[model samples]
Target: MFELIEPIATVSFSKVVTEAFLALGMRNYWDGYFAGRAAPLGLAPAEVVHAVFYNFADGEVARHVPWVWGKTTPEEAIAVRERSSATVLRRGIGVLAEAPGLVRVADLAARAAVSAPTEGRALYAALRTLDVPAEPVARLWHAATLLREHRGDGHNAALLAHGIGGTEAHVLMALTLGMRAEKFDRLHHLPTARLAAVVDGLRDRGFVDAVGGFTDAGRQTRERIDALTDELAAPAYDELSADELDELIAGLELIAAARYKRSDD
Candidate 1:
């Protein structure tokens, strides 16, 4: 019953304000959203492979994310992403079409073209320099991904700044989401003993209970970390006007609603 998100007026000024980060966070949601409709895309090995391909569209193959998941060899993962880039991109945009009011999606894409770029987000910077398709949805997808990567890069920095390593952060997040810790131990390639030590540390810090579930304090702490991450990510949007930000929120909400509705069906 703890409030799941901050009030709209306080933490959210617009939909575009957070869609990339929101979308970036919802890999599971996207996986669930795309779960049933795998016929035409020919996504194989089902669950894990589809997720790997879907995420790869927003990221390049050589990056850490594909390898980090532990579902396949890094080489195979890279090849799958690289080979299926166009297919994944096509399917990703197709999901947007399932939503109502695509005119808003187009508006979001156009306004995004006006935002200034920033430094340190290598993927976003590289994406901005690419010669991608001229189609509006494709452009919007790319633009949103750029913003997602920008926010992602910033999130990594904030995590590092807070002295959180990749494994511990993964464990903490998985636990908070009600997933089995053993699953993450495998997914993150963390040793059992190492994961136990991290869990003990979390328990000592009052982040976990005797049974290893999050304490109330742990949940609050997770919320604080999320809010701090958003604060750290805000600099990427510093140059945009209020009007432009509003359009982004509107557009992303349409897409999210459509996808979530599709998910519920």
Candidate 2:
């Protein structure tokens, strides 16, 4: 059971850091930044989000961003990819300036060692050297995004190795995360009839049962995917000694708790 410590810790850290994106995604200030940048390219919000955030196919983006499902053209998405990532980074910086835990997380990341070549660690290292907008919060959020992406990129790889496609992965996620299976279509922006077919296919593959629940085997498989993802992402934390890693995890937990606490209030 304790074998899962690294992945669990890493996932928690990633989620806490990535929460800023969600906060940023909701703010008009960040929206204006993205819209301003996208305007020059003649793309809509959905198109630019699908282009910049996800590197997969348009179909996958459709699965992730509900509004992008039928509203945007693949040609437009492809074209939006040509826009500079600096725009997103700038928007993120602006949002981070107003985020909680700004100085704390930034200071932690600045003191962290890049112990591995995992995408997250490398990105974190690179971001640390940038001009960083002359603001501590922006610098902090920038570093946090790199660390978040590292784990995320690794998770996507693990999902692929598990033979799960983009849509099916979200389906599994909804069910596994305790969301009602019936709500999967609505939540993931998949058509109900089409998602039912995907469900049928998953059932046939022994990943689900007649009632659309994970079989014991299915649960085990998902857990394995998570475990492997954690293992793969473990090297990124190699810079921290065991004690230091634990301390970092505790700090991240506090950050996450603050997020939930604020939401509750």
For residue 224, give model 1's deviation from the true position in Å. Answer: 2.5
* lDDT of candidate 2 at residue 86, scale 0 to 100: 27
TM-score of every model?
Answer: 0.56, 0.58
Candidate 1 colliding pairs, count: 3
lDDT of 1 by residue, 134-228 (tens): 55544444455445555555666666666555555666788877985667543345556877887888788887899878889777767776777
Per-candidate local distance difference test: 0.48, 0.50
Best by TM-score: 2
Off by over 4 Å in 2: 1-105, 110-134, 185-188
Q: Candidate 2, residue 246: CA error in Å?
A: 3.6
Error of 1 at 233 (Å): 2.7
lDDT for predicted candidate 1 compared with the true structure: 0.48
In candidate 2 the C-alpha lDDT for residue 218 amounts to 78
